[model samples]
Target: MERVYIGMGSNLAAPAEQLREALKALGQLPHTRLSGVSSFYVSDSLLPGQPRYTNAVAALDTALEPLALLDALQAIENGQGRERLERWGPRTLDLDILLFGDRLIDEPRLKVPHYHMQARAFVLYPLAELAPGITLADGRALDGLLAACPFEGLERL
Candidate 1:
């Protein structure tokens, strides 16, 4: 089984409950085992005037391929009423494949090591709680990334 990290966020419809349900859903995916989960965190919305977001990172060990896992994640999001009407827009859930077993994947539908994770405290701090020494598929150290990204607008929940 390959180890994978998932970045999860919710800014609507009972955000904390959404993450709890999403974690339950992650554990139920076929051929996958939910391994680690960081504590929930709260942060201001990326775009102004939106509700604050609840975010966390989940780790899974899975035999499923990356795209298949992506499909399952999207399914979970949709089941929880995720709407992609606007980019960085408010949503009930957002599930992103952060790192997929040291693999660098760039496809029309998925990208591993997720495009902008290094710059987001909501992603980095919780991520460090699970795997402090991890290195991205692109060779950037997690510790280094954490140093560059501060826990300014985030609060542990």
Candidate 2:
């Protein structure tokens, strides 16, 4: 089974509860086991006038392939009332494939080592909780990323 890390966020409908539910659902996926989860952190939303977001990272050991896992994640998001209304808009739940077994994947539907993770404290800091002193599939060091992305405006809860 490949180790996978998932980035999760929510700003609508009891964000923390939504993540808890998502964690339970993740554990239920076929050929998968929820191995670790990070502390929930609150950060302001990307756009103004939006509610602050609750974010965390999850580690999973799964035999399912990347796309299959992505599909399951999206289903979980949809079940939690996620909407694709606008870029960086508020949502009920959002899950992204952060890494998949040190494999660099570039697909139309997904990208491993997430294109923007290096710059987002919400993603990088929580991820550090689950996997410390790590390196991405693309050769980016986690510590280096943390150094570049300050943990400003992020409150661990």
lDDT against the true structure, per candidate, is: 0.95, 0.95
Question: Where does model 1 exceed 4 Å of error?
Answer: none
Per-residue lDDT of candidate 1, residues 42-144 (tens digit): 9999899999999999999999999999999999999999988988799999999999998999999997789989999999999999998899999999999
Query: Which segments of model 2 are wrong by more than 4 Å?
Result: none
* Model 2: ten consecutive residues of lowest lDDT: 81-90
Task: Report the lDDT tens digits of candidate 2 across residue range 42-129.
Answer: 9998788999999999999999999999999999999999889887888999999999998999899988889889989999999999
TM-score of 1: 0.98
Candidate 2 clashes: the total is: 0
Worst 10 residues of 1 by lDDT: 109-118
How much RMSD separates candidate 2 from the native structure?
0.7
